[model samples]
Target: MNTSHQSFAYTLHDVTCLFRKHFDRRAIRYALTRAQWRALKAIRRREGMSQTELAEFLEMEAIAVGRVIDRLAAAGFVERRADPNDRRCWRLHLTSRAHAVTDDMEVLASELRREALAGVSTADFEAFERVLGKIRSNLSAIESGTEAGAEFTSS
Candidate 1:
């Protein structure tokens, strides 16, 4: 692989780490941890999803997500309702309180994104997004065994 290709992976990792660091610094003012913010955002995306589904979506352990839900519930930000289709499962829902909080969080996130992309032109930003989407799709295909590179073996 060329040097530029090798640098691409490092650049992506560094960008992600730096973004998280900045977000974490800003998140303290909202009295929420990065994990809590992540959980909240995932829940907001799929309001009626079960804990198992959430754990999968967040790529976290179910127990860890349960703990996050517990904290959110204690803070009046989330609620769990019995699943009508499955007695053993609970459907998670955001409270009215969480809705208001989510709105404020959205504004904060927008500000951070704007600051991060200050010098980028709209065309460049759109192209970057498309490239990211393609990368994700390619990776997903490999993981699902649909792509030829799925058979990864440890040396």
Candidate 2:
């Protein structure tokens, strides 16, 4: 194995950490914690998702996501509507205020993305994305035990 290839996982982790750190710093002005902003973005993507569904999508505990939703609701960024089909469940919706804030967030995120991709050629970026997508698919398969490392072999 190439020694440089061994560092791929570390490099990926470092890049993700740095991106989140930079976003956290830049997002501070919005007066929302990272979790709050993340939840808001997730909710925006799929409006009227149940809290349980949101928790699963966010990969967060139900209780923790509940608190994030609570804070967002208090801030007038979200509203909970009773689910008619499931009387005990609440369907989440973004308020008009949240739509405005998320629009601003989208602009801020675009600026950050542009800054991160600076000097990268479009073809190179596209290739990078393709590779990452493959990696994600492989990992998901492994996690589900559908692949079970069946392709592994001695070099």
Candidate 3:
């Protein structure tokens, strides 16, 4: 690649690295990995979500989701109950400890987000969100093979 292209790639990698570093440092006090925290928040939004549903919502693989659940369960941050209507499925629920951690996590995340967007105005933020949404949609369409006239497909 050209020098400019290589520089852009390194910049992107640095941004990703910094984001993960900050998130891990802040989230460690809650005794959760980033994935575990995301799963917990999703469960809090809609309790009793099946593993498959959680995986779909997070755009993650079922096995990866299961690993997060396992860690959270072992730490007493979540409970996995057998789905009443489907014996084959398990429903996820946040424990009391998880709820307590969520409040602090919310504050920490908000502060971090504020710092990240320190100079951005509300309008700018909204525009950024819209652009991000479009990018996400475009990537999803490509991944699903639904872009242009292609039929829907999944990897």
Global fold similarity of model 3 (TM-score): 0.76
Cα RMSD (Å) per model? Answer: 4.8, 2.7, 6.1
Candidate 3 per-residue lDDT, tens place, 1-155, comes to 34454474477579778877887798886666778888988999999999999999999999999999999999999999998998999999899998988888888878888887889899988976765566578778779898633332323
How well is each residue in 19-101 modelled by candidate 1, as lDDT tens digits? Answer: 88887787677687788898889889999999999999989999999999999999988899999999999999999988888
TM-scores, each model vs. reference: 0.87, 0.92, 0.76
What does the lDDT come to for candidate 2?
0.89
lDDT of 2 by residue, 8-99 (tens): 88999998998888888887878999889989999999999999999999899999999999999999999999999989999999999999
Q: Which prediction has the highest TM-score against the true structure?
A: 2
Clash totals for all candidate models: 0, 0, 0
Overall lDDT per candidate, in order of appearance: 0.85, 0.89, 0.83
Question: Using alpha carbons, what is the TM-score of model 1?
Answer: 0.87
Best by lDDT: 2
